[model samples]
Target: MKCFEKLVRDFITSSLPASMNPLQFAYRHNRSTDDAIAHLLHTTLTHLDKGRDLSWSRHTNSLAKKARQCLYHLRRQRDFRLPSKVLQNFYTCTIESILTGNITAWFGNSTKQDRQALQRVVHSADQGQEDCEGPHPSQQ
Candidate 1:
């Protein structure tokens, strides 16, 4: 904690008098390995098995919930006689965007369960999009 104390001391002297909020900081105990810290980057950092691993369970679950909500909206618009292209645009903007946001950062390391959960969202959206567009010309 010396480093943190030194930094706080320096900042207080150089800038306006500042105070630290005890609740805003997370400290990992020497004997604890299950502690996790979540940051604004939409991912959780965990120290497990003596190594640092990024857990995407929470992030994926959140994305799936949002994407499913978007899918509901897409289906509603389709029932309202919205154009196929407009529905496609909506899916792209809402559902797809949520699933793909920062994908490269966490997807590669995500567990299979997390990946499958996300895939289910995509699959449902795909089925909705297909229904929105009707049967393919070749299938007729």
Candidate 2:
């Protein structure tokens, strides 16, 4: 858990804005469970884009930060809490590792346009994975 926390924390600290707060965002989705994660990210980004002084700013937390919040939302109560830093560490250590260093290209580019292009590549890479993996024979 410590390693997990460390990786996620680092990722959050660096990937997010230096002056941004992670706990003032909220996300909602028409479909629960499957779309929850993406919804959270979208909401957070939107909140940040709207600035911190928005009326809704006081009522939210970053999706990663919320993982440690009330757990009874969709199911059983969550007994453990993980902070933004820890969550960043976990993501970096786990899924970030899977990026095999491509994440550097995704975020560390010299220009905003370059970064955006890299983001498209990442998106395409993600979509490609779904096609590549397909459905299991058992499901057919």
Candidate 3:
């Protein structure tokens, strides 16, 4: 068993580049073991707190920050008298892309609170745009 373990470790080390630190997490009974698997690089693996419950807060926070920036720029463009269609296209390209890109992979892993927070951010952006235009043409 020890020899087999060594061979597996060796294979892993050989497969990955020297710059990367391969994290070996042993999952049993929906819980990760406390063993220090491998520490080649200085960076530790993220979202290892509760095994199956992968925390997406870091990724979601980054998305939210980016969305906020896009919204700020969109609002600024609106101030400069850009057409509503152009602003909508900008929102679709920039803000929506940030919100929906890679969503399928991480959405399921996100907590309810995290999802709600993201939804709120999106809603706020929509509301902000609507407020600037006094209701969309579709609504009228």
lDDT of 3 by residue, 1-140 (tens): 99998788677657765554334443222324433422311123343543654578888888888888788888788788788798889989999999999785578668788888788878877887787789888999
The segments of candidate 1 whose C-alpha lies over 4 angstroms from its true place after superposition are 1-54, 137-140
Q: Write the per-residue lDDT of candidate 2 for residues 1-140, one digit (tens) a residue.
A: 99997787677656665554444342221334435555565576567657553222212222212432212221211113434344345544543344334332223223454344334534543343333345545667
RMSD vs true structure, all candidates? 10.7, 21.3, 11.4
lDDT of 3: 0.73
Q: What is each predicted model's overall lDDT from 0 to 1?
A: 0.73, 0.40, 0.73
Model 2 root mean square deviation, Cα atoms: 21.3
Residue 55's C-alpha lDDT in candidate 1? 73
Q: How accurate locally is residue 51 in candidate 2, as Cα lDDT from 0 to 100?
A: 52
Decreasing TM-score order of the candidates: 1, 3, 2
lDDT of 2 at 61: 22
Q: How far out, in Å, is residue 47 in model 1?
A: 6.7
Cα TM-score per model: 0.59, 0.20, 0.58
